[model samples]
Target: MKTEEVLQHVTTPLVNPAFAPVVPRFTDREYLNIVYRTDEAALRAVVPEPLEIEEPLVRFEVMKMGDVSGYGPYTESGQAIPVTFDGERGEYLHAMYLDNFPATASGREVSAYPKTIGSPSLFADNGALVGTLDYGSQRVATATMGYKHHVLDLAEAAAQITVPTFMLKFVPGYDGAPRVAELVRTEITDVVVKQAWAGPARLQLFEHVLAPLADLPVREIVSASHILTDLTLAPVKPVHDYLKGVRS
Candidate 1:
């Protein structure tokens, strides 16, 4: 499908404002954060068997423009280490993309999340890693990875999510080896907090958001990442696991 057509088709109901707004830490940040950590794990039961865990270590930030509630971005920064999935070990690299950049210290893109701090690897190796640490601009994250953190209200639908999503997925090979595939993701949008005691400010996801990906034609949210030769992050030196792949 044409890129413009796809985008237009999906953004019919979705709207955005000019300014990048911040999620109110008072109104919902703390409460939502608690519920998410507690409820997020339950989603695994719904995913297919082969997919393993659906939610990785990801951060979702929310923002507002005009009257529209959902207008923001997601910067996925994490790594996939060698793991025995279905009794096999492989690695995976993960990242996320949307129309807008999350409201951050400077409205940075997901790709530029690592620069927020001095961290390196986003995904830590629970056991074995595919390659090693990346100290080069062309580092394809053979082992670990990292991205940015977005603040979300933690309600049902906080930040509307969409595709053209980029991910570096590693999987176990036939002979207990590792293979990589770019897995796409389903588009998602944020919904308002279910509780009324909360505030009037709420993001209505699924119903108000565009893209139908719950039941029908499943969405394959992935985009192959390419290394840019001209751009260099500078100071490509290997750092410790804890030191890399994390943001404040």
Candidate 2:
């Protein structure tokens, strides 16, 4: 194929391409987020400088997506730390574990999402909403919450979506060297909150060689929330281009 023809190919072309498309819209997404108070020093060690942490907090989420536009159904769970970029409150994604391979590739390349392959699940059983993550046969994290014990205000729950989400975009060079690195920020807007809930919950993190959730070491379970919503994942914007600054 000619160089000009290669530039016009989309969907990754099943071979080699610069980037791929990941425009997925989720419906009836079962989301459970657990906020925990972690050690300030530990949080600081992971979160890069220039992003301040008003409170030493981290949020872990497990989501079961019903129908993804191109990709079929899949489950994902990950952790993020609350931070402030340029005085704006947001969450920086520390790690993401997913089950689908296509979504993983598109997420990391297109949006620079810190995605990795793992076995994660979200379900409701015995009047409780449960989420679990496992690397191989070893369980890494488990979260359980009272099923819709208390109804949450839709507006209040939706407000959280307005906060920008941040992640690192790092592309290594061909020789395994660092090629591109940047801080990317994205937002989820026009959220239609079908239902929301809040109640007492518990989270447990275990140590595993591959998927290590216990590294963060949750000091206390601050709060937990269950939000059922339909939302669109918008395009991301690079707030800090590390390569540009270095090249200059």
Candidate 3:
């Protein structure tokens, strides 16, 4: 069906209300990662002994994710957007939580991760050692190193927001430990949503809430997933409390 028709078909409830435009997002992640652990002996075997090994021991722990929360904008909007997480929904706000806009944030909070591959070689006596590897007499060490990314994927409550904004993070320092590395923001140049139904418990706020917005940077938007946590790394105070300050 046409987009307009689909929008038109949506119905409404009866109560026109005004609740806070904020909610809580709780994100718990069991992020599995690889950490590099090197030693003096190993360091001494990469390059010609006598070179300073800027970065030594290295390992890449493939990443895995575990989620366990159900934060959403339900309490505020009262419109169930329907977000399904972990193969199911209903008990949580997964079915109804849509998306967010950290990408549009000018501050652009960053996260880091780790590096994977490396190349090592042995140097000769009296051989000049350059580059980042450590070297000493009677020993070889590693040289230039980096990560060979497997792949990157994105998904949320229900349908994967195919175009959800994102960025890659790498481990900081020369160590390459998976910290909240470089962050990727979608750079939301503009946005527009049209809602057209509502009532009381019996109310619909589809249009009243989503319309009249255009070309807006996504960062300002505290989204449904804001209450979902990790997706939206909020400030120290809970998102709801922050909202209170905004509208107060």
Candidate 4:
């Protein structure tokens, strides 16, 4: 193929040379987020330096994307740890497991989202919003929240969604060392929360070698929320590039 032909192809070049739009807007999404207090030491251990952990908090969410623009329907479950950077508080994406590969590839390449292939699901059970994650034959995490228990303040929730989120992007070098090491940040925009609810919830993370969610043991279930929203994810930008000694 000629140079121009190769450059025109979409989703091919593992890492794009220049910024090209890769939009995957979600229209209908059902979300369940469970916040829990975790081991203080574990919370501190994974949080990178300069990113402070004010609360021993970890949030596990299971979302079902109904109508995605580029990608089809898929489910995702993951954990985010509450952290602060340079006095700005936000959540740092720790790990994410999804059922779709296309979304997985784009998320990693575009946003540095730590997405891996796994069986994560979201459904209703006994009138509660249920989220589960399974790795092969082992079930690693399960969360259940009371469905639409209390009306949530949409304005407050929208503000929360606008907060900057962080992720660690690492592209290995030829020798298996990190070629690109960066702390990336991204925001969710054009968010319209059609409905929201809050209620009690429960979470359990089983021990598994592949999905070691139990590494951060759940100490207490703080709260849970079920939300329906339409939103777009903004392109990710690097907040810190370790190799280049850049920080912002």
Candidate 5:
């Protein structure tokens, strides 16, 4: 390819990209979010600088993508910590595990999402809504909630999902030095809340060497919600450049 063609390439492989260059839209994107308090020290350790913590709360979420625009159906599970950046409240995405390669690649490469390959699933088991994450053969996390016990306010559920999400984008150079290091932010703009509910819930995190979600132990289950919506993820924009004003 010519130099001009290379400059115009959006993603890797040049000839055939891993995923199409389109903002993903979801139809009936279901979410099982369990917000709980954790150790303050653990939150301090992982939550990067320039971001402040207020209550040491973490949201464990499992998302079931019913239909997507570019990538097909997939399930995802991850952890996000509530934090403040420049005095604004937002959630810092800690880790995300999904079962789809295109979604994973696009998330990490294009948007700098902390995504990796794992086995995560969400389904109704009898009367309970269950979400689980597994690494290889061992189960890492499991969350169960009473199905549709109480109707949740539409505005409340919409507020929770609309919060801005912060992520650390770190890419190393060929010589093992940092290439791209920045804090990026994004939020869902076109969200149509289809249904939402609240209920009693419980979560369990097991010890795993690779997916060490148990590092931030769950102290107390504060709240739980089951929400279904159709939304589109906005493109990410960098908020802070870590390498700025540095001497080489």
Candidate 6:
């Protein structure tokens, strides 16, 4: 490829990219989210600077992708910590583990999503909604909620899902030095909340050295939501550059 063609390339593997360039639109995307309180000191240790923690809260989420524009379907589970950026409340994405490679690749490379490969699933078992995450053969986290016991207001559910999300993007150079370090932000837009509900819920995080989700250690189950929606993820934009003043 010519130099001009290389400059125009959107992602790596110039000839054949891992994922398409089109922004993915999720149809019938399902989410099982449990917000709980955790250790304050532990939250401080994980949450980076420039972001302030409002409460010792963590949202454990398990998402089932019914259909995506370019990547088809996949399951993802992770945690986000409630924080404030520039006095605005938001959630900082701490960890994400999914089952698809293309989605994983694009999430980490094309955008600043903290995505990795793992086995995560969400389904209805009997009268309960079950979400679980497994690293290799060991279980990391499990969350169970009453399957749509009480109706949740559509506006409230939409606001919960559309909150600003922050993520840290870090890349190392070939010389094993810091190449890119920045805080990126994004939010879901054009949301159509098809269904939403709230019910009793419980969460358990097992001690896993690899996944380390248990590090947060759920203290109390604050609330739980089961939301189904069709939405599009807004493009990520860098909000804070960690190495801005240091770089020459």
CA displacement after TM-score superposition, residue 141 of candidate 6 (Å): 0.9
The residue-by-residue lDDT of candidate 4 on 1-248, one tens digit each, is 77897776656653643323458788878888888999999888888876888889998989899888777889998899888887888889999999887888878876799999999898888888889999987899999888788999988667655678999988897988788998988889889999888998999999998888899999999988888899999888888778775422
Q: Model 1: per-residue lDDT, tens digit, 1-248?
A: 67775565322233543334332121222111101111234334323234454332222221112222233322222222111234433222222112333332222322222122111232224431122212223232222111112222333233212111222233356976543332322222232342211211111112111221111111221211111011111111111122123422
On a 0 to 1 TM-score scale, where does candidate 5 land against the true structure? Answer: 0.97
lDDT of each: 0.24, 0.86, 0.21, 0.85, 0.95, 0.95
lDDT tens string, model 3, 1-248? 57775564312221321121232232332111112333445334432211233433222111111331232211111111111222332111101111122211111222211111222121222322111111122111222112211222222322222122222333344555433333222321122211111111110111112221111111211121110114333322111111223431
Q: Write the per-residue lDDT of candidate 2 for residues 16-96, one digit (tens) a residue.
A: 543335477878777899999988888888898678899988999998988877778899999989899998889999999
At residue 233, give the lDDT of candidate 1. Answer: 18
TM-score of 2: 0.93
**Model 1 alpha-carbon drift over 4 Å, by segment:** 1-60, 63-97, 100-203, 208-210, 213-248
TM-score of each: 0.19, 0.93, 0.16, 0.92, 0.97, 0.97
Q: After superposition, how far is residue 120 of candidate 2 from its true place, in Å?
A: 0.9
Candidate 5 wrongly placed segments (more than 4 Å): none
Any idea how many clashes model 4 has?
0
Q: After superposition, how far is residue 132 of candidate 3 from its true place, in Å?
A: 27
Segments of candidate 6 deviating more than 4 angstroms: none
Q: For candidate 1, what is the lDDT? A: 0.24
Ten-residue stretch with the least lDDT total in model 6: 8-17
Task: Provide C-alpha RMSD values for all models, in order.
Answer: 20.7, 2.1, 25.7, 3.3, 1.1, 1.1
